[model samples]
Target: MTTPADVHGVREPGLPGRLLTVERDALVPLLRGRAEEDFTLPVAACPGWSVRDVLAHCSSAFTRVLEGRFEQGVFSPACNDRDIAERAEWSNQRVVDELERGMTEAGPVIAKAGGVLDILALGEWVHAGDVREAFGEPGAYAGAGLPSALSLMAYVTCRKGHLSLHADLDDADEPLRLGDISGRRPPARYIGDGPTLVRLYAGRPVDGASYELAGAEAGELNIFDE
Candidate 1:
């Protein structure tokens, strides 16, 4: 395995910056159209959520970030579910209002809480990928923030647990063995190119089981959803 570098406080590379901007702009419209589109979305990735539910989750995230309410990191599964259930019938104007507040306030809030950038970056890429997957876009890795994001995930998982099932890298012949770190701990594995991997490690898994590995010796990998 290639030894991962420590990019804990480093800013994302420039290419991802461009991609991030595009994704940020497109996110609102995608959320707004959640109800009308099919996207053939999987329930497992976002269980108990209709396409509208995903939109609510996004809106809640924007709301939390804008409110400067960083307590408990400003995002949680329960919070997302509540927003989805309560705001299920939100109008486009309502989404526009909340997103406007989010865009207006995100800068200062993030400036005050610099550490949250990692979450923001990962969130952007993962959600973008989710949107792309729903639309059946191929070669989704072309999206920005994916590379470094995945690198971060690979690094974190190595420390948290081990993989039992082998992962077949594109150019490599031998599959990477994925197993548990300790019998009782979670199994580890990398997902996505780099940024996407970081998103998964950060507990998003927006695409659900797309990156899941099977046939592990110790146990299965337990990916978190919040």
Candidate 2:
């Protein structure tokens, strides 16, 4: 449980840089203060995973990227679960150390991935929120990462779904289009904040009234579920 006062030094450029900086400056500090028992608390947003398990998963993902091992699917629950299982023997501090190292080492690799980095950032921010939620803390739904994370999420989810839909994020200035770009037209649109959209994508329950769905069925195009 130590502050990363020396975490900032060489900065990677672009969104990857921002994401890593946020992870180091914001997310890392949050975890540093927690007691050992806190890590065992269940994260409501991520079923079957404890707070430590979520960090282990995130650490493993970053480490894999640093090792140039990338998952093929949009979401790999099995792979993620396996990662957490494999690291089960490690102390909580060891997991955090790995995360910090991986973030530093994987920056160049993430930068080279182009648009794929957005999906990665989305995963990171969402998991950070999961940790916060598990500890009964308010999440950074409106944080610096939200706009880019939501945009990347929208792009990936849109690409995966068969239906075309438009999304207007209240916190964002632009509208997000989902589904096939070549399709004749979209049948529905979504109007919501970044938090609602992220929660829905993560398969967490959201207040029904938080967002609006028009002209199509909602919850049909979850990127995380795929």
Give the number of the best model, judged by lDDT. 2
Model 1 scores a TM of 0.55
For candidate 2, the lDDT comes to 0.69
lDDT of 2 by residue, 1-226 (tens): 1111221122223556566666667777778889999999998878888999989988888888877776575137788878898999999999999987876676677768755665576677788888877888865454656655555555555445446667677766667665556567655778877777677666666765378878765566566665
Model-by-model lDDT, in order?
0.47, 0.69
Off by over 4 Å in 1: 1-20, 26-35, 39-43, 70-74, 96-108, 140-142, 148-226
